[model samples]
Structures are given as structure tokens and as C-alpha cells.
Target: MAALLAARAFLEIRYLAGDARRVSEDRSPEDDLERIRFLADVCHNMPGIAQPRPWRPSRRGAPGSSVQQAMAKRPMGWAWHTAGPEKRAWMLRHIENAGLQWTPPPPLPARRKGPSPMTLRQRAGVLLGRWPVRPPAGHLSLPPEAHVLKALDSDAICALYEEAGRLRLGLGKGGPWLRAHLDADSVHYLVPDPASYYWPGMPSTRGEIDWWQCTALLRMCDGEQVSGMVAVLPETFAALPSTLPRRKQVRLVHHARTTERDTYLWGRDHKAECDPQLCGFVPETTGDPPPDD
Candidate 1:
């Protein structure tokens, strides 16, 4: 009975780990649920094997000490501990091998593409209803080091920023708003932090330090939920010379668009109260800081 139980546990672990590998490689949330369901089913079938449980690492230190610790810490794979220590170690090795297999291939070198041009009217239409999505256009083409910024019509950027005001939610520290609205230029783009995503020139150029980059930063920052003090912030498009002129400094006012404000209020009573100025940080600008409002 013990031998059969051990064998069943091993099979269950392999199946669950395989599911986890698929989810990790594909990054499909649906796959994650499927993995969970499979694990639950395994626990149901293998009555002698301990039921799946959450992994809880020891607070003292030395994470991944035991199967219990590892399972507790992981978002998935809690069923590996059903067997003895030797079996658990074997299961872990298999899981590790699976991880190596799923390791993402190096990103294909970026080939610049498209004109990505839009008139002010078109930009407005994007902002009001749909996301501004156009491949590089005009001189822009795949291969050359060129990029374009398309503006979304809705105040999605502003809304994301305001909601993140109270909570610090992100893969890491508080980051720049991935979505941004410019009262000065009346433009929007996706601006993510240079550090968050893997890129060639992350520290130097902030991983695509352009208009779209800034917009994504605002959007990312806006959605981040912070439990403790925010350690880092994503780069700002508002401070970028490409987006904002050097001689001019723009005040990042809390946007007055009631619809977006109400939509993404960070548990604030009044959306108007949610508006706060951007942090005081200088960009990689050549000249002195722009005049503050």
C-alpha cells in the first residue's frame, strides 16, 4: 500500500509540475486554473497521499527548506509534499528541469516598424473610444531603430494613476504610470518603467524612453498597490524632453475628467480629492529643471 501510494504521489507531482510549466511558459491565467484543478483532482484520487495544502515558508529564514515550505511559498504546486522527503526531493528536481525547459527564448532583436502617424482628430477619436493602435508608418519600418506612439481616447491613463495612489500594487516597487495624459500637449501613450521589463538599454535609456514609454509608466504606476513605503517609481514621460520641452515644465494636475476619476477612485470619497501632483524628480534632460507651477 505504501509503495503504491508513493508511486501515485510521484505521478501526481509530475502532472502538477507539468501543468505549472505550461502555465509559466505560456503565461495564460486559464492554464493556471487548470493546473489548480488538476492538483485538486490528484488529492481527491490519492486518498493515502496527503491532500494538497498551501505552502507556508518559515519566517526565520532559509526559504524552500522543505516541501511544505516550498509549496506554501509558491502560487501553485502544493501537492508535491504528499510523499516522503526523498520523493519530494525527486519531485523538486523534476520541477526544476521543467522550469529550464520552459525558460523563454531570448527576445528577437527589435526591428523598428510602421509610420504610426495620426492627426489630432484621429488622436481624439482614439482617446474617446478606442486605444490608439497603429504600426509604425511613413519613414517607420521594421529593422531600423524607430518607434511610434499611439494615443488612446479615454482617460484610461489618468484613471489608472489615481487608483494606485492609495495601494502599492505592482510586480515590484511603485512604478511610473504606464498610462498618462498631458494637459500641455493633449496626448497619451503607454509608458512602462525601464526597469520593469527586460530591455537592452534599461538604466541608460529607460527601456524605450519615449512618449509611449511614459504613458505606459503612468498606467503601471497608477495600478500599483503599495503596502509599505514605495521604494522606486517608474520613469515619467512628463519629464521626458521628447515629450515635454526642456525650457517648459508642466504641472501634472490631477485630471478633472469626472468619468475616469470616478471609475478609478482609490477608495477616496471624492474623485476630486484623489488628484495629487506628480513626484519631484528630474529626467535626463540637458538643461536645468523646468519652472514649477
Candidate 2:
């Protein structure tokens, strides 16, 4: 894993250097940054590469160059060169002309009502059943709308991945659930490292998935808004006390109650009770540890 990661990074640096040399003949510094950013996004988003922050497309340059002129058009060679063939193909799906263009997938076929919790084996079978193991570079494709329906007929497999992340949060570390592999039945397969430990707004290397990040990803894929209720890993990885006592829990419950009440009163114009037991949140009146522990 480490070797593959190093090689990918080395390839990126080489590609950036080569691109800089090639484009320098006609482009300026600002153009170089834009190109680099595009390539970075492609590489960083790939499953194997680990980095914080995805590629950020920007047009600005150091103090004296062109400030805001629209960038010169170029083929997505930067993306193709840095990203693996699988990613290169995915990026191509979004390309319009030589640039990336967001094309919302056509409306999916209406979902079929179905059973739940298909195992890793089942999903691998379905994915393989639908497409060849590998397609030619830049030629790979998603199944047609009807076919996607048949393949992911139930959202359960993905849901299991999400649940795995959540369980990790309470456990405070990786365990069997976090290690659940994704692939056809009975044997091993690859799964992307959980995104929980990642810093928000940044790309992160592959590692055990974080529950909060899993929650967000699941919501994004399902096209739903994320809630603030999801908890983040503490900024510092300092060891915390194993568990708080009942008094602390009670205090937290009270604080949550008050906070919830005030929030509802001011925002929703409703007088709502803050139930420590029901909501698991303490009112502000009590200074307590976070309920997440």
C-alpha cells in the first residue's frame, strides 16, 4: 500500500514537472497553477491516494501576473496524466470539450422496492455481473439507468458501510466493523478507507473510516442534507477519560435541554421541553461533557 502511494505521488510530481516544462512554451504561471490544481483533484480523489483536500481550481497567480483573465483552454491532459485509468475515465465522463463540466446524471430509473442487507459477496457479484473487470481507458462507463437500478436495487450494502462508520465513533477506534471488506462473497476485496479522520474541506489519505465522515458521505450520495448532529473527532488525538460518571452525564443532559429549548424558542417560535433522557442532551444549566462519549 505504501509503495503504491509513493509511486502515485512520484508520478504526480513528475507529471507536474513535465507539464510545467511543456506548457511554459505558451502558458504563464497562473495557467500552470490551474493545471496543477486540476491534476491534483484527479489524483487526490482516487481511492488509493491519501491526501488532505481535493484539487481546488483557481485562476490567481503570484503578485504580478495576469489577475483575472479567463484561462487558456487546454485538454484535460493534466488529469489523464496524473490519475489512474479508472479515474481518467471517470473524469472524462464530466468533460465537455477540453474542460470538465458537471453533467448531473440523467434521472435514475424509478427505484424498485427490495430486500435489505445484501453482503459484500452479493454486491461484488452484482458489480461484476454488470460490467467487465476493466474497460479500455477513457472508455469505461456507468451502467444505463435501468441497469443501475437492477444492480443497486437495495441501498443496504452502502448503508452497511455507513453503519460501520457510526459504530467506530462510539468505539473510539477501528475494530472488526471498520474492517469489513467489500467484495464478492467468501473472499477478500478492497474498500476505500473510511473518510472520518479527514479534515473537512480537505482531502485526506486512506485510513480507517471515521463515522462522522461516513454519515456525510452517505448523505451526499443519497442527495440529502447532512445534519449537525453528527460528531467530529476531537481536533487533538489526546487520550480522553474512559467514561464520565452519572453526575456528568446528568449535567450534560441538562445543558442540552436548555440549549434545545432556547434554540426552539428563538428559531421556531415554539416552547419545547428539553428532555435529557429523550434527547440525550443536557441543558446549558448543567456544565457537562459531550454526550457522544
Candidate 3:
């Protein structure tokens, strides 16, 4: 029974050291030494095991006799080997907390190739608004061109023309109202018709020339609001020379027929309003434009 218990303990030690080979029945002192050396090697090589620092003597000096003092200076594994079961168990717990374990962690699963075809389809559907198209609550109609001009004074009209010409020269968007300071006293303004979609340098949309002619007359009264109207046709608006003067500025405004202020107010009040569906029709320039007052 004594031999059996010793063999069991030896096997347990061997297992901790990760040695699978069977132990010899007639093991010698040399064999025991070799087993201890193997366990020391295993503990040192374990990933999370901390390196043991040299034990220091107390301020009072060595704790015991010269023989005991020498033992204290020996390697940590030497103490571990001589420790009782309770001390050994405590050391094993510390080892576990340090992440030193017998078994390795499992490998991670492989990643997928790419987004599936169905996912791509769903994304396309969302972008095109084909999946769920909601109609707008109220349609914003443009007032007649006469009404829009009546709201502005002659100075405002000139400022609009100068600024619109400047924007046309630079091919950029003017904030709020299109404005240009032509010297201190000279400024021009023009009501940009938000219904026109200007795609400069591209082929003019079907009936664009006729639509502009009618709209220009309606907005500026054939150059009555400021100076002569300059129609920036697709090619002209896009590739016109930067040196072109205010005389060459177009009287057209491009976008949905709604002012920035009106759009902001509408969005603020009707938070859930759906975006209006864009119909390819050019708006009529004959009727009274939407009321600005």
C-alpha cells in the first residue's frame, strides 16, 4: 500500500510535468533527480509562469544556521519539491491564476469570404428606395415669377444679378441669396428658380432652351429686373470663361422649387415628412410663383 501510494504521487508529479511515458518500477536516485530536473524545466518553460527572484535575507541576517541559509539561496523548484501537500496545493493555485495550464487554448474559427449576394441586393434596394418608397405629405408648388420679383427692390435685383454672375463665373454655389458687391454702391440680386437642374457642360435636357426662355422672362421680365439675361446653357454654364463679366450672368436657378429657409422650416415642423419623388418634368414659368410673404 505504501509503494502504491508513492507510485500514484509520482505519476501525479509526472502528469503535472506533461510527461506521458510510463515510469520505471525500479527507479534509482539518479532517475528521481532527472524527474525533478524535467519538472523544473517544464515550470520554467510554461508561458505565464513568472521567473523566481533570488530570496533575500531579513535585516536581522540569516534566519537559521549556515546549512538552512544555504538552502534558502537554492532555486525556487528546490523549495517546491520539499514543500508539504498544503504548500504545494497553494503553489498550484498561484500557477493557475498566472494562466499556466496543461491544455492549450482551442483555435479560432475561419472568417467568411465576403458579403453575400443577398446582402448586396438589400443595400441596392435601400439606396434606390425601391424596397419601401413613401409618398411626401405635402407637395411644395412654386409661385409665379411675378410674385417672387415683387418681393425684391431694384437694388436687391442688381445685387442678385452680380452675385449670380460671379457664381456662374466661378461655377460655385452662393449661400442663401446670390450676392455680388460690384464696388461700394453697385450690387445685384436675382431670384434663383430652384426648379431648374443645371448640369453644366453636359447635353442640355430636352426642352431646356425653351423652358429657360419662358422662365427667364417670367423671373426677370426679359432683363427688366437687372441687366440683360444670360442663359447659361449646358455647355456655356460649364465651360464659360472666368473673365466673363456680369453682362454674361445667367438668370436661372437650379434645384427643387423651395428656398433654403422654407425647406428648413418645413423639415423642422414636419420632422417625418418623406422626400418628394423627382418627376422629370420642367416646371411652368407662366403662373404666379409661390408666395414668399
Candidate 4:
């Protein structure tokens, strides 16, 4: 802006009327005028624009500048962008010497956005079925029966994952529910991962269906609407406190927390530092990484 102002001022002083007929314009005299304007516009205790009072654009139509004369110049732009290179360099140095230190701010970042919690719950609504018995491949189905709970929440549904139980989805219509799953049958397929020091997920040995999918499926049956979120390990590593509370049975309920963001397994990266009994997993051998080109 200072540069723009200085350039505009130069345009007015040189091309427009100032000295009646002819003034070759000696540097020393003209620069003194610029220094005075620079002081008034850019220095401390500036009139009506200092602290507690901001420089308002509506009043001036442009950002405050070192060269006040530029703000008054008839047309904005007015060849300011196309000004001679030598004059531009001179104006830049003039503004720089006048204590102009800031660069124009960069553009703002894009907003963070995604599916809302209700939308997520709706998504979870679609993943449900009888866990032990899947319906025919072509049709979408719910549970064998639906229970109308006075109230249901994440905690209520998460409890089923901790040990065992059954869940069903229903049609508001008439009789039988759409789908169902035997919650205990899920645990038999799970192996406690010592390295994680807690239950990791609803991973299965029998099929590709895993914790991420299971979490969504279970949320659909909960008495309350549940967010369709799943546990995720960050690309970076951090320590996760034991989800398994001391002296209590290991449970998968912690993953159901809405505030839960990243889950970590410290032993995955620092196996030697973690306790063997609590965090040990047999190490798998891997070939050395190939060299970078």
C-alpha cells in the first residue's frame, strides 16, 4: 500500500499540475516533501488513526499509506502499477526508510468440514444387520426386533461390546425386526493385543469385518442416536493411556466416546521401552527399506 501510495503521489507530482509551467524537479526538495507526509501518515500519534482508533477504509477508500498525497490523487491505480522501474525502486526505498515493515497478509485457510453427527448416525443406521446371521445379499436389512428404550446413549451401546449381548433393528411398521447380531460371538474372534495394553478394536480372525465396521454396526442398534465414528491411528505416533482400567475387565467401550480422536499404541514404535507383560507382541521381521533414488 505504501508503494502504491508513493507511486500515485509521483504520478500526481510529475504528470499532473503542481509547478505552473515547468519544474525539472530536483531530488532534494521533492524528497523533503515526501518525508514530511511519510511522518504524518506512518509515524506514531498519527491524527485520528492511532491506537483506540483504527484506520477505516470507508473514510479513505484505501489502506493508509506513507504518502498521504497518493490517497488524494484523482484516480486510483492511475499508472501506479505501470510506473517506471527507477521510480518504483525509489518509492520502495522511500517507504522502507519510513518504517514500513509489514507485508500484506496471506489469504485465509479453507474451513474444516465433514458429515455432522446426526448424518453420521444416519450412516450407521444403514450398516446394521443380524451379526450371527446376515440377510440375503441383495436387500438392506435391520434387526430381528427393535426395543423402544426410554433413553439410550453411547455408554449403553458400548456396554454390549465390552462383554456380550444381542442387538436388533426394527421397522416402525408391524412385527419382526430387520436384523440382529450376537454381541458375545464377536469377542470369541478377538485376540487381546498385549502391545496395545488395551482392547484395540473389533478385529476379527474369521473375516475382513473389523472394529471400524463393527463400531458403526453397533451404534445403529443403540437406544440413543450415536455418531458413526471409528477409532483411527494417526499417521504420527503418541502414547494412549490404557483403556483397560486397572483391576477391571478390558472393554471396548472407550472407543465409543465422541471426543475420542487419535488412538495410540506406544509399543508399536517403542517396543523395547514398554513393559513386556503389558505391551509385548511378538516382533515380525521385515526386510530393510530400499535406498532412496
For candidate 2, what is the total of clashing residue pairs?
Answer: 25
The model with the greatest lDDT is 1
What CA RMSD would you report for each candidate? 20.7, 20.9, 33.2, 23.4
Over 159-269, each residue of candidate 2 has an lDDT whose tens digit, in order, gives 343444464443222122112211213211111112222323233343542322211111221122111123234321112222443333322222221121111112122
Worst 10 residues of 2 by lDDT: 59-68
lDDT at 292, model 4: 13
Per-residue lDDT for 1-293 in model 1, tens only? 22344455556557556756665575465765665564445444344334444443221111222233333343234344334465445445554655543222232222122112344654454345422222322222111111222233226444444444443322222223222213222344332212223222233333332222222312223442211111113333233324432111111110111012211222222223323355222223222211110
Candidate 1: lDDT over CA atoms?
Answer: 0.31
Candidates 2 and 4 compared by lDDT, better number? 2
The alpha-carbon lDDT assigned to residue 66 of candidate 4 equals: 21
TM-scores of the candidates in the order shown? 0.18, 0.21, 0.15, 0.17
TM-score rank, highest first?
2, 1, 4, 3
CA-lDDT, candidates in order? 0.31, 0.30, 0.31, 0.27
Cα displacement (Å) at residue 253, model 4: 7.4
Better of 1 and 2 by lDDT: 1
Task: Give the Å error, residue 56, model 3.
Answer: 98
Model 2: how far is 206 from its true place, Å?
A: 25
